[model samples]
Target: MRMLLNIRIPHEPFNAFVRDGTIEEVMAKIPEAMKPEAAYFTEQSGGRGAILVINPDEPSQTPAFAEPWFLTFNADCEFRVVLLPEDLQKAGLEMLGSKWK
Candidate 1:
């Protein structure tokens, strides 16, 4: 079964993760922005899995922009972790793994 986990990360830590390729590595690949406020998609582990990063701060002035973004994983056992800008650092990999399992 696939699950979605919501988390928060501080700005600095979040940026650091992005810089070190942690986020990209976990998500499998880079995300593509479908709508300004929706979300982005990426493949994880050389296409073994996938991830979707939903930007809560996406533009919401229009209905079209209110849609939630998503990332699709082609693998059978897959999950998505949606991290808010504030909870990145507070949420660790172990915690996520436990929650997912």
Candidate 2:
């Protein structure tokens, strides 16, 4: 399944990384290692943030995707399952809703 990884980096270690110039290396390496479908960097709640789209083969692989960011930047990571248009069509939402109703 596809997943959206909401990553929020706090200022402390992140700012230090940016200052020392390790952030450049990290930015290049981590994303390359993860091979995310997409990566968008932004600010969230007054802090550095990123949204990474990844498709992990197993739930157990979550840590593989999140750990480096957490360890390197003291980031907070949240994972949410996401559906593409085809996935939504496959979900049979109408049937489920009718049955539940």
Candidate 3:
């Protein structure tokens, strides 16, 4: 399944790493672990943040993807299932909705 990963890095250790010039070293390792289909770096709540689109081999594999962020950056991570237009078309929602009605 396709998953969206939102990583929110707290100010303390992340800012310290930035000031000490080690932020790049930390960032380089992060993507290597996930091999994200798409990745974006931006700020959230005045802190470092990232949004990653990933396809894990299995649902059980999510923890492995999140561990690096937690151990390295003390990041607050969230995972959400997502679908593309094709996926919605495949979902047969109209049939289910009619049954419910």
Candidate 4:
């Protein structure tokens, strides 16, 4: 499944990491852990944030994808399943809607 990881880094740790220059070291590990198809960094809610798109082989891999960001930045993270247009087309929504009716 395609998953979106929303990461928000708190100010205290982010400031500390920046001061210590550990931010780059920590973030360099992200590719190895999440194997993200795409990633973007930006600001949100006046904090540092990132959006990562990844596909874990199984649900058990969730921790591996989330833990590094959590430990490094004390980040608040959310994982969401997302669909491509092809995935949406395969949902059988018409039949399900008719059944519900």
Provide the TM-score for each candidate, comma-separated: 0.20, 0.96, 0.94, 0.92
Give residue 64's lDDT in candidate 3 (0 to 100): 87
lDDT of 4 by residue, 1-101 (tens): 89999999888787887798986877787766667999999998988899999998889998898888888778888999999999999999999999999
- In candidate 2 the C-alpha lDDT for residue 4 amounts to 100
* Stretches of candidate 3 exceeding 4 Å from the true structure: none
Of 2 and 4, the candidate ranking higher by TM-score: 2
lDDT of 3 by residue, 1-101 (tens): 99999999888788888999998988988898779999999999987899999999898999988999999888999999999999999999999999999
Candidate 1, residue 46: the lDDT equals: 40
Residue-level lDDT for 83 in candidate 3? 97
Give per-candidate clash totals.
11, 0, 0, 0
Full-model lDDT for every candidate: 0.37, 0.94, 0.92, 0.87
**RMSD from true fold, candidate 4:** 1.2
Compute the lDDT for candidate 3. 0.92
Candidate 2, lDDT over the whole model: 0.94
In angstroms, the error of model 3 at 66 is 0.8
User: Mind giving the per-residue lDDT tens digits that candidate 2 earns over 1-101?
Assistant: 79999999899887787898888888899999999999999999988899999999999999999999988888899999999999999999999999999
Query: Which regions of candidate 1 fall more than 4 Å away from where they truly are?
Result: 1-4, 28-101
Residue 44 deviation, candidate 3, in Å?
1.2
How well does candidate 2 score on lDDT at residue 51?
98
> Best candidate per TM-score, number?
2
Q: For this target, which candidate reaches the highest lDDT against the unseen true structure? A: 2
What does the lDDT read for residue 40 in candidate 2? 100
